[model samples]
Target: MDHDWMYKASYTSEIYAAGVQSFLSAAEANRVKKRSRSICCPCSVCQTFQYFEDITEIEAHLFENGFMPRYDCWSRHGESLAAFSTSSTANDTTYNDDASSLNSTYNNDSSNLDENDNHLNGPDDNLNEMLHDMETNMGDAEIENLQHLFEDAEKPLYTGSRLNKLDAVLNLSNLKSKNKWSDKSFTKLLVFLHDRMLLEDNELPISTYRAKKLMCPMGLEVERIHACPNNCILYRKRYENEHKCVVCGASRYKQKKDSDEVDDDEGPKQPGNNIDVYLSPLIDDLKTLWDLGVNLYDAYGKEHFQLHATIFCTINDFPAYDNLSGYTTKGKKACPVCENETSATRDVFSTIIFDIMVHLISHIVQEIKACGPVFLRYMYPFERYMSVLEGYVRNRHRPEGGIIEGYTSEEVIEFWQGYVKGLDSVGIPKTRHSGRLDGHARVGFKTFSPSHEDLHDAHFVVLKHMTCLAPYANEHMQMLRLTHPGKDDM
Candidate 1:
């Protein structure tokens, strides 16, 4: 009963071993009462979700990985509240009797139950709940694909094979990606396996395209929402069927194409101030989350609960802040907090520039007071992410599509990486100097002697960029020009 050994003692310690032994005995008793061979393993790795029939395997897992943190209750292993309290005997008896009756009824009518209902009592309760939640959002084709994937997951790659159909396909896809295999090469390999190796009857895909299609259900679904050609608004909700832009009055489709698809090359490069229109979907989702909340499974708790959230504050650069906050970030009255009280200064030309950015600096303290901290609301992370998105844009003419495709591929690769362990990573592999300090290379080093000209050039470059030497360098240059009139300054 003293669960302190879980955290205080090492897995190999006598206290921990005794604790695991006691836990297994109780769990085994519970398993026998439920007429089940397997009991949920409460080890950190298994987390009470994965079931194990062999008691020795469960014990080994606990010894190797230790029990899941904060599992003192043992609720899943049949240690109920009634066992701790004698006062609840009458209420516990009544509840148990009703539960037994319900269980008997369900068992008697098992044949009439739906496929989803059958999984309700199975170990894959999380998967069933997730699929049920996705049903409302996914199309018929996506749902069918997901169901097929689920079915394939249970079937082994071959007789007595440890890997399932899903695992085999995922592992193969990961290998192809990591090795940078060409489509033709992958197809040939698949052909060799299926034809020559005699694995054609198994669930192995014969082509790279087929394999990708099979793995489609595992990737996140992308919704292609249409937006106004003029970047005024998205053609959704109220403008779901509108032919022309409500604000700009421009036709949604290209005149030459005579179709609903707008030419990507012809549209505005960026949404500019109309970004709010593009963020309508995100805003709606946030509003729903704040109001009604969403049902999400808590892995640690082993139950579903309503998750509610709201944006604390927006983090963006000045230009983006102007568009999202609907405040002018330039000219006079640019400071939203100061507004009319913004201070102005005249330049050397006696012109009042009214630089909003300079004036806004004075009110940074007030902004920080309202928004918690400057670092919390800074655009450093967003700017770094923008660089990553820029790298994804292979096709400059259709940067949006390029980024979406690249990002989706990365997401799928990442998903596969989670399932197919021990494979080489999918993206650009990290260099040896990844976590090293700037200018420090971890690779084998070589000494180099710079020539006189090279050394001079390097010193000149370093001195030219040094802020402390700037005034002196400028003064020396002025002296040189004054001392040698009509001569080249260099």
Candidate 2:
């Protein structure tokens, strides 16, 4: 609020702008001859300094790490600074008192001081009160009278305590904790770990690696990978002693399930430390995604391009669109384009399409390993998992568009030609289909001769509008007797 701080902010902002223009010019020159000058940095501040290397790096760090909105961000930072300045501000308490006494008609102490002031100050909740008190009373300006209360309301039952109470609550004496041997839940666990060989540090944190060799169409980056890529997702055999293990995917959580707990008639009990296991939700997530992948293939191969959004429509209570089947074309209720329920449904799939893939794969490994006895087939371990995946596709991962390729125009054409056509029409060699493009069916959008750039834009449009499905992915995987993220460190 002071002129000094205001002047500094303006100077900093201008510096940010000047830096971005430099980066943009450089990036534009680097683009392919036919490609658009679309040098996307995603970080708005970085976008501003598209040309300056040093300033752009600074902007990138700020955006990637503490990328909060301006006012909230500024207010939070100010609150932190005020916290550190408490003693100094107290030194100003006398100054405030002297200033207030000058206006003897005003009683400031009676204004800002209140019962809740004894407790923690609510962030947004105190804004209106602070303004009212500042206008009415003079005591609010006193540093001693205006002590800051750090509220950690974001954490449930978090009352400014460093020690976690949940751990104690979980460690009670007489609780008939789950016996992992239940036919419902086997002691099996899934261990999925992927550590890219790249070293990382605070400077270049979460070293991103492209899985170029991973047979995936849409390449992904490993944020914190170390040499080993674990789980079914990494697509390599687990190197440890996988045989004598119950195969639980827990890494560092103390899961309950004694080896001897299972009955003699049921099966042989595997042995281990049993508590600390390693599993990421991404594994089982892949299994569920594979099912959707199968369905997509089935639908598209047979020219069943009715579209995933069409299949999702059969689910009751889902939102529908005007001109869409089951909804009247005229007099139908609709909001703005983004607010439309149809887009919401599509987005549920589009955004989560890949996350679903990750979660499905993660779940599949955990389900078979953790719930070994209950698991029947080697392929489709849990029957409910298929329905879970379908429900997720319909209810959760729904995207405005049904694909998750993060596509560009060129990529879109390649998808249609290499994937859509190869699977449904022309043949691709030596892969899941084995020496020829696997499966059969008429596919629309194949050989449809669209410009390369248009295809990319369409794919990006689909991805940009995509949404993720976390509820179901977290649900089934946890239900399968595997440890959840909050339950473990890894």
Candidate 3:
């Protein structure tokens, strides 16, 4: 292949265009031969760190940003090592300053190049950075285990297979989650694959337990903190060794395990006014984040920095807001912002009746000044998320478990979708709202044409309500009234 076009001054040149077309054609052929939809994009922006499924996108990126420096080998795009070596030896004069600088950075060590290349070929740049960070903090045994994981990630699922063991396991895990397969069934499927389909030396895990174990290191740890049964407090920090709740004096655990009877006199499950006790852990984390921050590696920048984060604001309903902010949402002096200036009054029954919602309106201006806008700190988004969680509850009896299972399945499915190209989503497709905005059906099964009268009515309603067109409509109406003094105002 002619390589001079890659060094052209203008991407719009005919030679550059032809070269890009040829490169894409070869990449597409290689992709088909490997039974994969995506290829590693070697554009300067991607730097061979990202995979692109669409050839057009790849082409555009290459044209816009040009190829990454010193990427003449094209090993990542299925060019043979022998061919690359032969080309490099024959075209010694083609090697430029960029290649020299890259070589000098690695001290001209072949091992260094191999190590760096291997690191680059890892699952993702961010994932590689995380692994690199982990390697620094981990013990020898943990490092060995991580290395084994890397090997598994790099190893092909089977001989001549395009997919790696890690990808295969992830795909299977996602399938299991989406279909809600039992552990036994998942294990059976794994076994069937191992016994009947895969070769004897295949690296696939034979059980759900093994699969989970394989992927466990990559997952975030979930802390299980014991809380007061009455929702008074969590038994952590100062109360770690305490046997009972500090406020309610309720026992941490039930004395009898065999009894499944419910107490009719038990309080509501919500922490209510004692929500602050449950928020201790979160508060402590925030304090730490504010004061110390955390060390993190920026994969894109290829640098390390400390990341500090703090909660901008809280969003909740009026009653829950009271619990979080330690303000009384009902009765006299209910307004946290107004303080003593509240307008509460006693009713005929000697009851302090005050519209807490109306009182909250006084605080909105101040809140907006501090947090930009009410929408930014409003409960609508949280309410929508709660609705989503509610939908995830399949079993009313075990709603929490159902939500967790559903959420985990969704996460798996989402992660799997990132890897597989052209795979249809598992759930209901999102409605496109084809004709809602444009006033014409661009895409859909059915189409209708509005009658002249209906169109006129719709247009009139739109023109009358639109704030931007209100002035123009009013001006036109004024002109009409002036022109025809006999006409009555509509």
Candidate 4:
């Protein structure tokens, strides 16, 4: 797990992150019916710190619309921009430095900065730094606040116990995070995580987050569940250091909760704050589903690990969507498969890898008329596939509602290439993109004019993966059969 990218976000004003931490702390407080405190955020990345903190009342607008596909879509999504950058493959050759860069925050602690922030009550140095940094670059917090104002915790019309992986990834027609994530940021992060997991192996270290436990259970006996100031170690460390790590002699001492660093005989690090291991519990749960082929918006299904693998394999990768207006679109309601409102979104999260698997499985089962080859020969060891899938999943994937609308043709095209090649290990068609005769699409050209070709490329990656999937499926089965002979039927 090249966790170097773990704390990548600028470590700035992610209100969503703050909110989650607060909510986690609050949950640990006495007198709560549910150990979990649910706060509403659009998705993981786009939420605000306040949102994570349980700053509002709970209410939900039940939506009823959209067709419910049992699982995620094997091939769907309006690829205005997503299709253009289909060059990135899960394969190594097409990896880029920028995608990784996007998730990581840079801490040039070579300079003397703050020390310990022991007193959460005192002015928190870490929080200050993040706030300062964000104010400098993003200007004001108008956008963040406004988005929050309109946000709602309305129960998703799509309710379900669980879903097939493919059926509802982006379904509002379906089922239902945080760095202090915002709705907008949540959408952005989802897209980021999806691409990273699907494309960048460096992002995921755990080949697969094996379903060893139903929950990421932590013992309060070993570690304090909530310690204010301690709860917000970042702030406390900054204050304690009098805003600097005393030992380092460099203002930036390695401490909990601080992003800035002081110069030292040693090189720079993120102050090694206690927050390193600390994560929003709910957010982590959200991530769990994401790894299992769910998206941020598919928050309706809260079931942990124990799910039907057979159903999971079929519904993982539904379709990608694009409604720039970013509102609920009316379609169908009261799905037959799950008795939930068929939302534009579903309860199940999804990923490109699972989608690919479903596509290939469907073909081998129905089209090729033989699931044996895929199960035996092409499927990489389930562990390796999952290892790679995790990395792909970790990369900043599609945030809640999905990617924002303001990309240029070139950017979209570039992203499309990166996504497909980096994610599926299959290259998109060059001809569809209007090559400059060398069979390569030229940079900065207007080659992207939405064609049916885009759709085929999106769906074809799954088809192509089928070519290799046969072997992996066989191996996956072989391994599973040995371990859980009774359950290998999936």
Candidate 5:
């Protein structure tokens, strides 16, 4: 919670500028000033000597790209400084006294700290001092204060202690895909590990409920609802207060307990047979994403197209002409545009001309005639997204809630991993020569093109090697011919 040492140990702009300015010889410095030209900066940041007007400009540029005295301190304390300011700024003033006082003691008691392997001078010595100050500044800071720093642009920032443990717990959830662990088993393992961590640290392990309350970053909770065992009806909507199924007349709950566990007989005496989860929170979050413009991907990457905002028409095999009056599919009175319609049910289908499909198809034909086939719309891509959602229901007690958890957990992992977003895991072939291309070489050896009338067995031998016509090949061909005696090719 307190990061006073971060500021103290960090190199000032002047120090880094001085370090770079002093790196040059007096003669070189004098030449640089006389020429009034840019020189290569010797600092770690801009080593290429990017253009600067004079020595003063070069010095200012070098100072802007300041050198860090301790890489470990900059890496560790940068996040702590940002976190200390943002997360708990109000109560931070109280910890300043303790931090300052402990820092003073550390300045005096340097030798005493050496007994614990904490040297006052090393690569990590600055970090050690800062950590000590943070500890003394807020006695419970190590356990209670969680770092919530803004993400770094170039590289991911990692924090120590409780944040790392929480990250590990989160990462363990991702092992579900490969190991296929049951929800109860996974949660039990996590809680067991959490308890072990507490015990090993000489801290009193708290209950699972308390640990979750303290450690869960998102603080998401499951919503539980009681429902019928048969899933015939949810105990919601008009049946919200119902005690029994309206259609089945089944009892909504089991018999009451006989002991003091039964608090009263005022309500239903038993628990419902099923627990249904309502994931309105997840739905609300998806909606929030939509409102925030994050759902722009839903437009199927055609957002730049002018027609994207409009739903022109739905594409389907709708027999629109068959619905016309006096049209009989087999009597030549069928649809002029469709050549495959038959006599069956043409008149019956005509009665449904007022249906939504016919109206949409009419508009689609008009759009196609005016523009081209590109204007047509279909539900195929949207159905693919439905399949993705369906695949998320594994290893869960509740399929509906399980999907939400799996999807959100994957998103979190992907965020931390900094993966290129948006469903990049589809149709990755085993090899470049896999799929239809694998048989291309064999297909090139075919002696002749196969006909629809040719039997599968005859085509198989032709596909293997078309050029050879030896005794063995002839005998194999003869055997195939004898197996299919009635074939036209035979």
Candidate 6:
């Protein structure tokens, strides 16, 4: 948790002293009237600070230990504090000189205090300074816009029985996947049906825009670039504002149909023929999933934490050491997995974005497996998550946005249903086969309804090939029991 290394080496001691001084000041200002010699320190140095005889001892403890985690102490940020050299101070300078310098810069209303002596500043002055900094950095319009955005984000998506109807329509894959009508008309129709099902209907039916807006949380919105129509090159970076393709000398944007009859008042509009969606957001989310797994483990123990690094490693097909370390194959081998041989071939025309992060996940699998199988992560269990994204069911135009909108809308509806009508309203029934059977016999056991009976055959056939489990037979079990007498059943 000691993050002093993250900042510049010169600023480390300054940040530490500033934090301690601020915390001591705040502690003194907020002290109780009752007689108590000791006060708790909550700085990063001591998250749950030990009792101190007075402010002097507390300040000394903080200077040595450095600040606590930012969450524990407001003084941890010290965004406006100017750096001062306190490295030369003796162990017993009390850090008073450096502390006073920090107080003069960060603490307002210092006119009341003597110049030579160090005095504790109130938390109110620090809060005002922070407020002034925030106002100076952010404009009125920006603050208002942020406030409105957060308000909209907090608003409920749907209410009542309409929520249930929306859920029903969302789960219908046939309707979601196939397009019999325009998205606008389709959304209107779904909303109309939902309205009819509700006891208290909406005065106006849910519009396509609202329905689409509702989906934003579920889907990831990717930043798309207009690429060359002939698949020559992407109009990004150096080519971002270019009007023509560098590779083929073709127009980068789609020309207006009425180009000859141009309006004098308005400028010509340039639209790209082909758009390439950026994958950074999706990659970032995947990386966040790794963070989430670790957090889950820390919060609720291993039973609630599950991440398969192996399958993710295998499917991703990246180097193990490259991600774990900062090693790369630039001007050397193609991959770290392949040794850096002198005669390694290089592809000059390669367009794929190959970086340590693109294959960083493989290292997780390798590292986990090195410890033992119990900690080895697999990617197979996450395959269903791919289908979950596909299930959003939106049009090709801004596909990522549509997917996000559709998924979030469905999630909001499901959440409302669970809240109003109990969790079972949105929960699927668990499927389990009845009766005891040997492993081979269990493979044939049908769990599907009459409508899906044919699917059961196909499912079982696929499962047998996909899985590595050995088949069992009654005769084999009996023979094994006889051969190894009094052996426990597997």
Q: How do the predictions measure up, each by TM-score? A: 0.51, 0.15, 0.56, 0.15, 0.33, 0.30
- For model 4, residues 269-317, the per-residue Cα lDDT tens digits are 3322343324445345556655564322222242233432221332111
**Candidate 1 lDDT, tens digit per residue, 1-490?**
3356677788776667666666766666665444444567878887766776566788889988988765654656656432323332232211112334433433333243332321212463343233333333343345445555545554556554445666677778777766656667989998888778745457678898787777766455678888877788888888889999989898888677667886567744677887887888999999999999998756436556899999976667878767887777776566667667554432322345446566656668887878677766788777877887767675677788867865776567675564444545676576866646576665675679999999999999998999999899999999999999899965
Candidate closer to the true structure by lDDT (higher is better), 3 or 6: 3
- Considering every candidate listed, which one attains the maximal TM-score? 3
Error of 5 at 407 (Å): 1.5
What Cα-based lDDT does every candidate model obtain?
A: 0.65, 0.29, 0.65, 0.28, 0.41, 0.43
What is the Cα-based lDDT of residue 485 in candidate 5?
Answer: 84
lDDT (10s digit) by residue, model 5, range 1-490: 3323323323463433233333332313332222222233333454332433234554555456543222211222223433444454442322212333433432343233223231111222122233322323332233224232111111111221222333333345445433546566766765676565544542222343333333333434455555654555666667879998776777799767678674454432222222112333344555665455332221222122211233245443333233323234334334344435333335445754433344345356666767677423455565666776667786444567767765665554444332221222222224655545555565446557767667787777776676565767778888888998877553
Candidate 1 is scored at a TM of: 0.51
What is the number of backbone collisions in each predicted candidate, taken in the order shown? 0, 75, 0, 160, 1, 17
Worst 10 residues of 1 by lDDT: 88-97
Span of ten consecutive residues with least summed lDDT in model 4 = 211-220
- As a whole number from 0 to 100, the lDDT of residue 338 in candidate 4 is 24
The full ranking of all candidates by TM-score, starting with the best, is 3, 1, 5, 6, 2, 4
Question: Considering TM-score, which of the candidate structures 1 and 5 is the better prediction for this target?
Answer: 1
lDDT of 6 by residue, 1-490 (tens): 1233213223346554554555555454433211223345544454432544355655655555544432321322221111111222322323333557544533442333234331122121222222222323343334433332222222222332222222333333224333323466777676766577544533223665544443322233345767665666677767789999888888987667755775564432222222112343445557766565332222212123455332144332233234334455344454555445422323322336544344434456666657555223444445556676655545554456666655555554454332222323322433464335434456556664655877798887877676353354456687899999989778
RMSD of 3: 12.2
